[model samples]
Target: MAASPTPSVSRAPLGTVPPTWLGKRPLPETSDGFGVRKPTPPELRVRRFTLPDTVAMLPGTGFASAVVTPAPARVIARSTWRPGCPVKATDLSWIRLTFRGFDGARHTGELLVNRTVVDDMVSAFHDLWDQRFPIEEMRVTRRDELDAPPTGDGNNTSAFVCRPTVGSSTFSQHAYGLAVDVNEFQNPYTKGDLLLPELAGSYLDRSWVRPGMLTPAAIGAFAKVGWEWGGNWHSLQDRHHFSRDNR
Candidate 1:
């Protein structure tokens, strides 16, 4: 068969073949990319004061003459009064606080409770609640009502999922247990599946009430109670949520 016609193929010019070790990584950006996080001035300022130990044991620790910070809103304008659970000036030990969730469930943490701080936190929540739920027909659910587990990474939690990245910080005001998440159905995290459509009218919205679209009024209510909003994050947002200083 004529040596099978020596089936040979021709090669292209040596330079036409690409280098075998070429890299595909993208080139780094020069001086300007965009969307960097800017720092905001913190609004909270702390002042020390004595709290009588006798008042610290009241249920949820109500207050009387606490030396709290003035509420930004007027619903509880006289919050400068005594706290429900004032710390005795002599006892500098931190007190445990219960951060309530939309459900009645709570996680325990501690904070420096002087009459002033507790009163400030309470008055803040009161005004916040009134502003956030202004419609008379609408009602704010008790912290005990929404019982999802805390940020679930690996630890055991009764909550639907552990979202530590979106939760109170280890050093957070929430560490002081000064925050809560109401109607979690309203605050859907990016993890897992999306929330049911039925909940949209109340808690879920892509705009003013979406993950990062939370309103200042909504944030203020929880912040007054010492809870910080996850919505404040630039890269992510949780509309129906609140926590304290990231803890």
Candidate 2:
């Protein structure tokens, strides 16, 4: 699967498949290539607002669990989807699952993904949950939030945003609902001076090994289902990303 360029306003023709690593290039020496030369200020890492957990956990059912169903019409209405998007709403599924939060409490979260990969995503997240991987939050991406003012410290775990690739006019795998971004603040996307969540520079220091940070084991959990981790990419590191096509 080819990776789309950075987020852009132009749209690709319907059904057009983007080329792999479309606009990727080597990072400059000054760029934080896989290590951090300077740390971000604590204030910059703080979230502008914290979203309250939306689901309650029941007592004594201490195992990872998931529920999958057809994508709800209401969810679609709030999502970034519009007609002519790469994937149809009917081909997507809504998933709700239990995850361990940074606070070490179990919480329910939701995602929207292509129906074909629904089982794979369920299995991968269950493994993470069992391993006690901490995710700050998980929810559907709303259309209004796509270009909302950057909170800088967002860590929303989400899948599916109907938009072009980061720097190109091509549709992102995300447009097809085949990609997921987990804990964006803890494991951010970085490429040649560009960071997805602009204030997440501190997380570039993979050596810190904080909770919610993805490990080799976590990568393996997704790999088990044939999903590729962007952390493994050479030109850029999207540590929070996982996708079916190595995008």
- Candidate No. with top lDDT: 2
Over the stretch 1-247, how does candidate 1's per-residue lDDT look in tens digits?
Answer: 4566767899753422323321221223223221121221121011011112222332543221223232222212212112322222222223333332222222232233333346544454355434433110111122332232221111001111112233232332222223344333334343223222111223333444432223566567656566566656655544444554453
Best candidate, TM-score: 2
**Per-residue alpha-carbon lDDT of candidate 2 for residues 208-233, written as tens digits (9 for 90 to 100):** 77667788999899999999999899
lDDT of each: 0.31, 0.74
Return the TM-score for each candidate structure. Answer: 0.32, 0.78
